[model samples]
Target: MRFSTLKSVYQCKCPRCHQGDMFLRGKLLNPAQFSVMNKNCSNCGQSFEPEPGYYFGAMFISYGINTALFIAAWVALSVIYPDYSLKLLLALLGLTVLIFLPFIYRVSRSIWISIFVRYKDEDLPSSA
Candidate 1:
């Protein structure tokens, strides 16, 4: 099922249903359903992707983005939330990474085709 909003490009689906919003409100808090994808298309009821291996690249994408976010976060925390013990800082950072990993995985996989996906029918839904 597609859970993506518009432009499947950034979606879990084609953008025509009850879903698309994973979070209750602000993005700072983790999304509610980080590991869940819609069971069926919200609109046409068609499968979101044609097959497996379809999302293989998603892992790589997620890794890259996650790494970047982690680095940025550690740097920011090191600068802003300074004064904590080294062990405590490291532990907090580790916890933070774990907390964000699943969410980032979802977003990265959801937007995996952002760079290469296309559609013959402009009217057709896309994951752009």
Candidate 2:
């Protein structure tokens, strides 16, 4: 099955095969496990962590996502409450970051890996 880049990235699928999950399943139910990732793609045998410290750049991606979310939350708050206080704005931003932290962490890593791993149409037979 062929998968679009955006779909693979959003779904946190392997960039090479787009079939195997880059992260362990059931992460949504457990926030602590949300950042855990598989070492390699089960479908294509592609290494998720090509090298040590490979995901360092993903920090920037996460930063950008957080910044955008913060800006959007600020704008929404301004529209929703023109007289919003500084404390209220800070609270909203903090909550927004907390709520989206897991998602942002996963997507940032997914995007970082996708930048280097090209999709392959041919799937490697699973050993399972």
Candidate 3:
């Protein structure tokens, strides 16, 4: 599949058709509704949930994303401030994770879906 498909994932659009929105409009910072996804793609009629427990695998993706983010932060901080204390590094990592939790959750779901679904040329409008 084309790497361009990742644009859809990053935008939280439908995996099959990049035009549709994957998530509903709401306060994203609100954890209670941070993951409110559309039942189906408004543009392509693709179901968001392929099956029961379909999103269970997304947890693993989320974990991987968090791990990567933590590692990157640690590496960057260590390089930039060689004498920074471990306590400060851990505090910054905690804050970063907390602030980005909603984003990571949504992106992980988008990535998990994109992994199983491929964009079809026919699904795109003729304008492309």
Candidate 4:
């Protein structure tokens, strides 16, 4: 079955075919392995990194995601503890960043690639 672009992105699937994984399986929480990605799409053979520095723009995406996370954390802390100290806020922000680094990194790359790679609805080759 065909998957929607948003679904494919959320699943971290190849942007073109939406079948192959963009990143290594079961590695999201593994700090060392979290950033590892498949060299190419197993189904469409699209290069995950089209060229050197291709992911430079993805860094900006990551920054935006982190900013949102920080804002959310600050708002939550404000509501949960009205008198929370600056130290507490800093600690919470640090913890939030550590907890969400992997997710943000992966999603940023997925979004970056999706911007350039359009989905294709066509029969896969005999060999994937």
Candidate with maximal TM-score? 4
lDDT of each: 0.56, 0.89, 0.88, 0.91
**TM agreement with the true structure for every prediction:** 0.58, 0.91, 0.85, 0.92
Model 4 TM: 0.92
- Candidate 1 — worst ten consecutive residues by lDDT sum? 16-25
Query: Mind giving the per-residue lDDT tens digits that candidate 3 earns over 1-128?
Result: 67668788888889987778888866578878888988999989999998999999999999999999999999999999989998999998999899999889899999999989888767546756
- How do the candidates rank by TM-score, highest first? 4, 2, 3, 1
**Worst window of 10 by summed lDDT in candidate 3:** 119-128
User: Which stretches of model 4 miss by more than 4 angstroms?
Assistant: 1-3, 123-128
lDDT of 1: 0.56
Q: What TM-score does candidate 2 get on C-alpha atoms?
A: 0.91
Q: Which ten residues in a row have the lowest lDDT in candidate 4?
A: 119-128
Prediction-by-prediction clash tally: 12, 0, 0, 0
RMSD of each: 6.7, 3.5, 3.1, 3.0
Model 1 scores a TM of: 0.58
lDDT of 4 by residue, 63-110 (tens): 998999999999999999999999999999999999999989999999
Worst 10 contiguous positions by lDDT, candidate 2: 119-128
lDDT of 2 by residue, 11-93 (tens): 89999878999999878547779988999888778899989999999999999999999999999999999999999999999
Candidate 4: count of backbone clashes, pairs at least 3 residues apart or interchain: 0
- Predict model 3's lDDT versus the native: 0.88
Best by lDDT: 4
